[model samples]
Target: MSHLLIPALFFLVILVGAFIQPAAARKPYASIPVKNLFSYIEILPPGSRVLLAWDYDPATQGEMQLLAQPILRHLQRKRVQIVNVSLRPFGPNVAADAQTMKQWPMSAQAAAPTEFGFIPGESAALRALTHSPVIASNQPRTSARTSGLRPTDTLAAFDLVIEFSASFANSQEWVEQVASRTQKPFIVAASGAVAPLLRPYQQTHQIRVLLSGYPDALAYESLLQHNGPAHRQRTAQTLALGLLLILVLIAATRSLLRR
Candidate 1:
């Protein structure tokens, strides 16, 4: 038997599986962070400003879509001022959301939460945003003729900056760039793969809230007595991980037996 064929088959299988749009993306579950976001908005006065950061790229979007969508919806519903920012190099896009990024609208019920746009790196951009007079000085996602909104406008006006990270910066970067510079409140939502690394920051108050993927999202949903996409995606995600572990174990066992 050819040993290479086994791993080759795995890739082939995953590619085919990708086309199927696994059960998770269709129905995602809400985690604790979602609920916490819901509650935070509940207590805040109407028309408050919030800076939303998408820290990861396409690789992590599927797992966190459940968290992102509802978070956007809740903010829109609460009439909160939203300033969308992305740290990921290719993480910004607009497709006619409930609230268009075209113009900031606070009272549109059917309105989707508005997006600001992508800045640059975490350190330089965040620092500039905290102090600069104009935001979106360098628009990575939009073209020159499209929208000319400055991220600086949103950053200066917003009260909070929530970083949805993937341990890309260890939470220290946000504290340094946004928190320390402007002394504004910032929160972090990290993937389970990197949540442990962020624990110290949460413990020390370097970051305000910590929302780990899947399970944490579910907890938040429970807190609000609301259920959403994160739950379903997490279920499928859970199943997928379980299958991968089993496959890994079997392969290890077979290799040991052969040895």
Candidate 2:
């Protein structure tokens, strides 16, 4: 039974940690990338149009939604007009579900996001968006929300471009097809699995800000003065890691005593 004790305790710790909620107010770790992202959004003038690309699917929705919630709130507070578009087929549904889950509060003066639906053809579609925003969108051109967008106006029409990316290639396509050509401030909130691959673009200044993983997400919430889902998950992760470290030390001490 002694041999099985540590493994049992470890699993117990994980089980407990998974349900841990945010307790005390922990200061979020300082992160430049997250801060830069906040600043980019902070500077946008009211009534400025922003192109928000939801590029992730249900597979990555868990992490992606946490990242998007705070961003959507910040944009609302800034009172920018958001135009949502997606590359993946399921992207629009995911975006809608996230909004529904939060029931995101909006001021009367703040306009809700105008959905442009899914744009197919990936890189080709993105390239087309650079030439004409309305032409690339799935939304009807006759709709009141998009009617204001003139044919001559391209990606440059939006003051900022933000993408919640699950795949590095999707973000890369945006950089090459749109950001480079339009010279707009582009930000990407990518999944941790793919964030490292997207860092080079940030380093090269092609991406204005790159936020990924729990750390950046928590840091961003800190910047916004909001304690969100990331905070709770991060707390749980810390607890599990701490418990594992204690168990390891205990096991090592017991072995030394016997020897």
Candidate 3:
């Protein structure tokens, strides 16, 4: 009873504070990370090759899609060559969507995005990308695997592989299977829930850039102020946090006065 009551009262206090304070604004989820990503892209040289590793599905698109699209846009803006691969079956197609594509500042030099259609088997498939890539993006120049990729194509000639996944087959797979074997840089953008596990990878440098949640995204948005969804989300988040603080203070004061 105490556990429920005290927390509930605090929530009520927070609600009241939100009504009174100007900080309760709601921002989009993508704003924070987008800004951080923007800065990262700004540092990269033009014409860099980036591999978009889509590893989630339609259900989680809302949280991840916006996050992924803006990064792709920023990379494309810089004329980055993108090679899209998916350990998840739906990842490759999601990577191909233009809504995700439009954000990039694509240039004449940008290679038409490459889709290495879903890797039929993750463990073995990921391992294959390390030494040489056997993957083929279903471009018309090639259709069937025979017309397409060889074992030599596994991890050839790419700069960085950005992994966007929402599954147990996580950054670890990219690390143990691909990055470890090939020594290629692996960047990961995963949901908050998976952050604890990913942190060790980042600390040890198994993954290069790791973004955990809305907080990181918001921080990035705050940094760039790019006037994109990330910025808008920051505004909303600022407002919401302000309100929450106010409510906490009010509740504490009320309790003290009563005592």
Candidate 4:
């Protein structure tokens, strides 16, 4: 009964909280990382080319999607030409969905970001991007031609590399094979559990920005002053956690009185 009651109450609170839209101002520590991410995107001039790697699959999409959406929206607002690629098979599809789900005017939509589909060879594929960008894409010849991306071009052509991943291997591969070699600034948006493992790289100055989980998401939303999916997720998380903690305390008090 306690188990059922606690979870039922939790879901009830979360369901109610998810509807509220306002995201409170975040603490200084939480705001710092989000501000750094925004600053990187803000520095690029309009129409600068950016390579965005969508590295997570559907199993982790709920969290990753929420994290990626605001950044994509921010990039679109800046009028950058985005070339998106993926290592995982379903990654292109996930990236497509995140773009489609964003609230942008059909007319104001920046040129639809180019999708390079999926690259099969992991570290080898990433290395190829630095040397032979077009062939590494595996994109149809005509599509590459239309985008004006020559086979001679390399990853160095892009102004920046931003990766959203749930996999540590994907993140590590990017750092060791791509960013470290190309010497281009890189950013990562990772699931909270995986963020700690990747933090050491940031400390060593291998990457620029790292955003992890709901707290960071809320901070980003506050920075943007635009509430979206992350706000909903944060509300749900906070309400559920707060309710569960209260329930535990009540149960302890009741047991003490009975004793």
Judging by TM-score against the true structure, name the best candidate: 2
Preferred candidate (lDDT higher): 3 or 4 = 4
Regions of candidate 1 where Cα sits further than 4 Å from its true position: 1-37, 94-114, 139-156, 234-259
Candidate 2: deviation at residue 233, Å? 2.6
The regions of model 2 sitting more than 4 angstroms off are 1-24, 107-109, 144-147, 235-259
Per-residue alpha-carbon lDDT of model 3 for 1-259, expressed as tens digits?
3345567667777666655443225433544334545656777776566667888887777677646655665676676666667877777667766344464344444556655678767777776667555433333434323223454655656666788877646567887887676555677888766667777887887776778665655555444444555555555766777677776766766765565
As a whole number from 0 to 100, the lDDT of residue 52 in candidate 2 is: 88
Q: What is the lDDT of candidate 3?
A: 0.63
TM-score of each: 0.63, 0.80, 0.67, 0.80
Write one digit per residue (lDDT tens) for candidate 2, span 204-252: 9999888887777777777888777777677677778767766665765
Best-to-worst ranking by lDDT: 2, 4, 3, 1
- Which run of 10 residues does model 3 get worst, by summed lDDT? 138-147
Q: How well does candidate 3 score on lDDT at residue 139?
A: 39
Candidate 1 structure quality by residue, lDDT tens digits, 1-259: 4566567557756654554554435443555545555667677566677777777666776565545555555566576656566766655652223133223243365323355466666677767767652444464434322223343453446666777776557356777667665655567777777678877777777776677766666655544444556555555665777677657656755765565
Ranking by TM-score: 2, 4, 3, 1
Give the Cα-based TM-score of candidate 2 against the true structure.
Answer: 0.80
Better of 2 and 4 by lDDT: 2
Q: How big is the positional error of residue 88 in model 3, measured in Å on the Cα after superposition?
A: 0.9
The window of 10 residues in a row where model 4 has the poorest summed lDDT is 19-28
In the predicted model 2, the residue pairs found to clash are none
lDDT of each: 0.59, 0.81, 0.63, 0.80
> Against the true structure, what is every candidate's RMSD?
10.5, 6.0, 7.9, 6.6
Off by over 4 Å in 4: 1-29, 145-147, 235-259
